[model samples]
Target chain A: MQLQYDIEGGNFTKAGFASSEIKKVLKQLNVDAATIKRIVVSSYEAEVNIVAHAYKGAVTVVIDHEKIVMQYQDEGPGIPDIEQAMVAGYSTASPEVREMGFGAGMGLPNIHKNADDLLIESEVNKGTLVTITIYLKQEGGQ
Target chain B: MQITELAKLTEAQVRCGNGLMHTEILYAAASDLMSDVLTIHHDGMVLLTGLANMQTIRTAEMSDIHCVVLLRNKKATPEMVELAAEHNIILLESPFTMFKACGVLFNAGVQSVY
Candidate 1:
């Protein structure tokens, strides 16, 4: 099953809707709890990034019996330094963003930790694409 | 401790998921910082924070937090309430300051995640 969500930038209130729906879908599908958690974490991190950093974006979720994949694409300022942004404590979010309980520099790192496979591609002054995959326990071959 | 007890102790308003208030919370962590909450790894704890936002609910859902209590008289937005409800998380609002709210919960047997 695949699901897509359009995220409006600067709309903090609507940020996590995609993740929540994904979680529900995963639960109804009866996936492993651990696998569900990984997907949820990754989806959430991506969703927040879309709301915080992007001008606007969409989140795509693909759930298979063996693994789950998530893709986040955004048209934004584009990260100038992927290496710096990957650091655990680096964040470009302003104080206003931090005030809402995010932008703590953990989004990307958390996404990386929770997903079995992570990929990020960005073009300066253009946009970004982040893809994450979490393999199911039954699919240990992953 | 149960979420019901924590709500009563903190004098928090149960905004949603009242039925789930019976859920047991084994630990508690109070922080407005998402990074701080992320560091704590309690599977079924109650999160107490003054920050009321969609990300707060998202953090709790990802971390397996059983419920959230917004302290310091902060009101949760409608979107936040809807998000918490969808996650099956109990959302509560308390007029007590963060410090006092944490103290009350601690006094009533809530322990930090660490």
Candidate 2:
């Protein structure tokens, strides 16, 4: 199954709708609870990043019996230094955004932790693309 | 611990999900940063956060958290309450600060995810 969603930047209230839907879909697909939790949390953090930093974005999720792949592409001020952005305490967000209890610089690192494979490509002023992949079933194992 | 008992320990008011007061809570996480909260996965967990916003509640929903206790006397917005109710998550408000509320709950045997 493939699912797509458009995300509005700076809209905290609507931020998690995509993640919630992904969780429900995974649940209905009989994905293990632990796996679903990982996917949902990763997706939530990614979704929040776009809402916190981008003007707008889109998420595409593809699910097969063996794995799930999620791509988050946003049109906004993209990361200048992907390496620095991955640091646990590096953030460029404003004080207002930080006051909302985000932009602690833990987002990308946390997403990396939960995802089996994480890919990020960005431009300085154009946009960013973050792809997260997780195995729905163990590789070479029952 | 029962959510009601945790509320009592923290001197909290149930802003919503009153029917969920009977829900049993096994673990607690206290943080204003929803990113950190989402990183931990625990069964029967309740989030104790000072951040009173829609995103915090959404964090709870994504993490499959059963309850959210807003500390430091922070009020839950109407939208937050409505969303929590929709998600069947117990929403609470405590007059105590994050440290005090967490200390109280910890003293009462509510384990932390860390």
Candidate 3:
């Protein structure tokens, strides 16, 4: 199955809407509980990132029998140094965003922790694209 | 701890999900940072936070948290209450600060989501 959602920048109210919907889909598909939790956390963090930093963004999800792939593409001020941004305490969020209980620099790290594989590509002054994959079934189905 | 027990410990008001007061919580974490909350791995945890916003409820929903205790007498917006109700997440308001709320729960044998 495939699904796509548009993310509006600065819309904190709707930041996790897409993730919540996809979470329901995953549940309906009978994805394992642990894997579903990981996917939800990773996607929610990615969704929030777009809301915190991007001008606009889109999330594309493709779920197969074996794995779920989520791609987040956003148009905004791209990360100048992906490596630096991956640090646990690195963030560029404005004061207002921080006041809302985000921008602690744990977003990417949380995604990294939950995703089996992650790829991030960005062009300064342009935008960013983040792709995350999580296996629907663990090895040995444990 | 049961949601009602938690409410009693913190002297909290059930802003929503009154019917869910019997729900049991295994662990708890206190944080104003949604990012930090997302990193928590515990299931069936209650979130104690001072930040009252839609994102707070959103974070709890995404994290599978069934209850949120708003500390410092913070009032949740109508939108947040509606979202909590929709998600079936119980919302509690407490006059205690975040630290005090967490401490009260911890003293009552609620494990920390560390």
Candidate 4:
């Protein structure tokens, strides 16, 4: 199955909608609970990153029998230093965004920790693309 | 601990999920940062935070945290309440500060999600 969602910049209210919807889909598919948790964490962080940083973005989720892939592409002030942004305590969020208890610079790292494979691509003046993949089959699968 | 017991310990008022008051909670963590909350991997945890925004509810929802205790008398907005209800998350408001709230729950035998 495939799903897509549009993310609006500066819209914190609707930030987790996509993650929540995809979580429902995963649950309906009877995906492993642990796998679903990891996917939700990574996807929700990516979703919040777009709402917190990008001008506009979309999340595409492709679920197959063996794995799930999620791609988030956003148009905004792309990261000049992806490595720096990956650091846990580095962030460029506005003060207002910080007041919301986010912008602690943990989003990227959280995504990295939860995703089985993660790829981030960006341009200084353009946008960022983040792709994350999670294998559905666990080592102890039934 | 039961959600009702935690509420009693903190003198919190149930904002929603009254039916879930009897749900068992194995651990508790207090943080104003939703990012820190996301790092927690424990299921059936209660989040004690001063940040009563929609993101708090959303973070708990994503983390499978079923209960939240708002500190310093912080009240959740209608949007947050609605979202919590949708996610079947219990929201409680307490007059205690974050430290006091967590301390109280800990003293009452709620394990910390460390």
TM-score of chain B of each: 0.95, 0.97, 0.97, 0.97
The worst-scoring run of ten residues by lDDT in candidate 4 chain B lies at B105-114
User: How high is the TM-score of chain B in model 1?
Assistant: 0.95
Which is the leading candidate under TM-score?
4
Off by over 4 Å in 4: A138-140
Candidate 4 lDDT by residue in tens digits, A8-57: 99999898999999999988888878888999999999999999998999
Lowest lDDT sum, 10 consecutive residues, model 4 chain A, at A133-142
For model 3, how does the per-residue alpha-carbon lDDT over A1-142 read when each residue is reduced to its tens digit?
Answer: 8999999999998889999999999888877777888999999999999999999999999999889999999999999999999999999999988998899999998899999999999999899999999989643464
Cα lDDT tens digits, model 4, B15-84, are 9999989999989998999988888899879999999899999999999999999999898899999999
CA shift of B67, model 3, Å = 0.5
Model 1 C-alpha RMSD to native:
2.5
- Greater TM-score among 1 and 3 belongs to 3
Q: After superposition, how far is residue B95 of candidate 1 from its true place, in Å?
A: 2.4
**Can you tell me which runs of candidate 1 are displaced by over 4 Å?**
A138-142, B38-40
> Candidate 4: DockQ?
0.87
What's the distance in Å from true for residue A84, model 1? 1.1
- Ranking the candidates on TM-score from highest down gives 4, 3, 2, 1
Error of 2 at B40 (Å): 1.6
Candidate 2 per-residue lDDT over residues A1-142, each given as its tens digit: 9999999998877989999899888878888778888899999999999999999999999998789999999999999999999999899988877877888899999999999999999997899999999999442334
Which candidate achieves the best DockQ against the true structure? 3
Candidate 4, residue A53: how far the Cα is off, in Å: 0.7
Q: What is the DockQ of each candidate?
A: 0.61, 0.79, 0.89, 0.87
